[model samples]
Target: MFLILIKLAWRNILRNKRRTIIASIAISIGLAALIFGDAFMIGMMENLIKTATDSFIGDAQIHQQEFRDTREVSMTIQELDEVGANLAKEANVQYFTRRTFAPGMIASSANRSAINLVGVQPSTEKLLSQIDDAIIGGGFFEKANEHDIVIGSKLAEILEVALGDKVVVTVVQAKSGDYFEDWFRVSGIYYFADAAMNSGMAFVRLKKAQQMLAIGPNVHEIAIKFTSTEYGQDKQVPFWKTYSQHGNEALSWTEILPQLPKVFAMSEYSKYIMGIVLFGVVIFGIINTLFMSLYERMFEFGVLRAVGTRSFGMARIVLFEAGALAVVSILLGAILGFVLTTIFANIGIDYTGNEMMGVTVQEFIYPVLTIEQFTVYPLAVFIFTIVAGLYPAWHVAKMSPVDAMRRSF
Candidate 1:
């Protein structure tokens, strides 16, 4: 019985090839828009995460309780070795490194700038952060080489410092109710993660920072990397709980980079808005074509009823036509979307010229190809098409055969 219905539906569709083509094209285009939009958003998010994580914070971090609230050197952790050891034991732990941050003034030949000075141990720093990869000029800081510093590219441009130029770093220390001043030279220049970090950040050796700040063996924070970034949050919870039990505070990258969630949420919202617009246009086209086809087949429907076709059977036939159209359209759309997205993923779409959230951008924008984006959009379109066909299908089912047969189109 089902096979007979399918055969009838197929024959009916073949009877009007032009209408089928039009409906299929509508569905295909709609599905393509949804898939491509989702893929583009996903790719952008991935890029954002990669750029932010590599250049600044790692997957996770451990900081002293006071440091989490106030950005002051007084919150420096004294038991660095113990915390590092505990974090290294976790199965998903990749590597960990310690850092100290202080607000200081940097002076170069061309200009003087106020920047956040990050003190890092040269060897372990690479494990925690990708500062090494972001360097566009000169080498990263070395422990043996004292009085050397790495400044962001924007900072370098502003300071007019080159690869081998000497820059001065001055910081005032408050120890035992007394103030001590210290200074160091710039050794390297680093490119910014974005415009913000570039214009106002600098890196230097931990020993050099210790010597300059006169704060020996004290670290403000420990950054951690995970073997797999996907389960970073899950892994972070237990670690934080364990550390918090011992009176130390651990922070995940999410907490440190508060803007990441907002960015992700905005992407999702934008995708939804785009999806609605695309689906509406596609549905309008498909429904208009289907309505015309149904009107043209009024006499055929009447003849079927006269020949003992039940109302339920007639409704099923109409639904079958809608479903078939949906299936064909979704398949074509999915194929086209996948091909275009794959091509774009390789070639990449550049948004460097466009300003995003008040920052000048760098690098190409690539679309992400996730299973949900490809499959879900087509399924949604199919469901909507099927549902939309119901009202028109019922209208046909209710028509009297005598009246329908007499009506002239």
Candidate 2:
């Protein structure tokens, strides 16, 4: 009977308490590592997504169909008021800001450098991006003139300009193609993890940029913050379709930074790699333990064979013993993993100000635990342990009663 085999398997492992405990611990450590590795990878990917989006790139962006390719000021978003109304009514949109970018030159008395000028509404920009918090000197649009400007600290160093210094800006008008020039006072200086941003970008008020560019209230891009970042990643979301109409294009951060999704895809392989590596060591440990246990109980196996027990029944007993060991190990490993993940989830791992591939992590990462981590991982570990017992099971079943009896002495 299966019940009799189960009882025999449990009783046999208990014969050498220390050896069984050690084997169980070995498998348990591997299972626990698998669980922890899955949790950590999930947390890190989330942090990467959050950082990529929150670092001046919103969860999603809306733009004219031809705008991104050209980077020409002429390709501004159409029906600006209608777009604003729709965004206001959309439940998924938390905050949105209008922006226009220009390739221009900024010059101070000491030096002049080519720059990318970004126009923004300071109040709404703070709601969407971390530029407000990244300021190292002065303030972001603190009740200042329409001519006020915020330049990067790196740009400031290049231009030899500081807060309160005068800088001349030059850009071509979108429609007439006539060159326009203006003077702006440097109101603030900011620092970001991206070297390009710190070295080449400057911020000025939307109103001033519009007036100078000869475009009235038309923006090249509308960056959107969503209710949840998940909505941005889900390509099937109705939000993308609804707004991606009327000669415009709507895109998630994933689409904007195509490289990030590739990196995310690569991260998925880490779980399988970790499982293989951890359980690879455990396979040998389990086999050795089972072989040792079988040899010590050779006299009992010999008596069973002599009493007319079939080979299938004997092999099944060894397999059942492996299952029992796996069950105990799974329990301990699950408990250990859950405890470690929970403790760190509360504490969180600090990775702020760390940049990778032009994106910076601006917050702490809390490990995310899911049902798959506990259920699927443990089940896989159990199956792996069962398979590891096969060779030992086969060896024990094929031996003759006389040979088993002789090995016992």
Candidate number with greatest lDDT: 2
Candidate 2 regions exceeding 4 Å error are 407-409
| Candidate 2 local distance difference test against the native | 0.89
Candidate 1 structure, TM-score to reference: 0.91
**Candidate 2 colliding pairs:** none
Off by over 4 Å in 1: 174-183, 235-237, 352-363, 407-409
For each candidate in the order shown, give its overall lDDT on alpha carbons: 0.75, 0.89
Q: Give per-model TM-scores.
A: 0.91, 0.93
lDDT of 2 by residue, 1-409 (tens): 9899889988888889899999999988888778777787788788888778887889999999978889998889878889889999999899999999999999999999999899999999999998989999989998758989998899999999888999999998898999999999999999976778888899999999999899888999999999999888999988888788888999999999888888778778867987898898899999999999998888888989878888877888899999999988999999988998888789998876787545676678888889998899989989998999999989878979988788554
Q: What is the lDDT for 104 in model 2? A: 93
Which 10 consecutive residues of model 1 have the lowest summed lDDT? Answer: 174-183
Residue 333 alpha-carbon offset, candidate 2, angstroms: 1.9
In angstroms, give how far residue 203 of model 1 lies from its true place.
0.9
Residue range 1-409, candidate 1, lDDT tens digits: 7888788777777778987887887788878878887888787777666555555678777777767777866667647777767777888788777788888888876789888878888788876666776677767875467767787888888888777787777665536423444445666666754766778888888866766666777777777787876755564356667665444677776667777867788878888888777777777776676678788888989998889989888888888878888888888999989998999999999876454543334557899898897677878988888877787678778878988799643
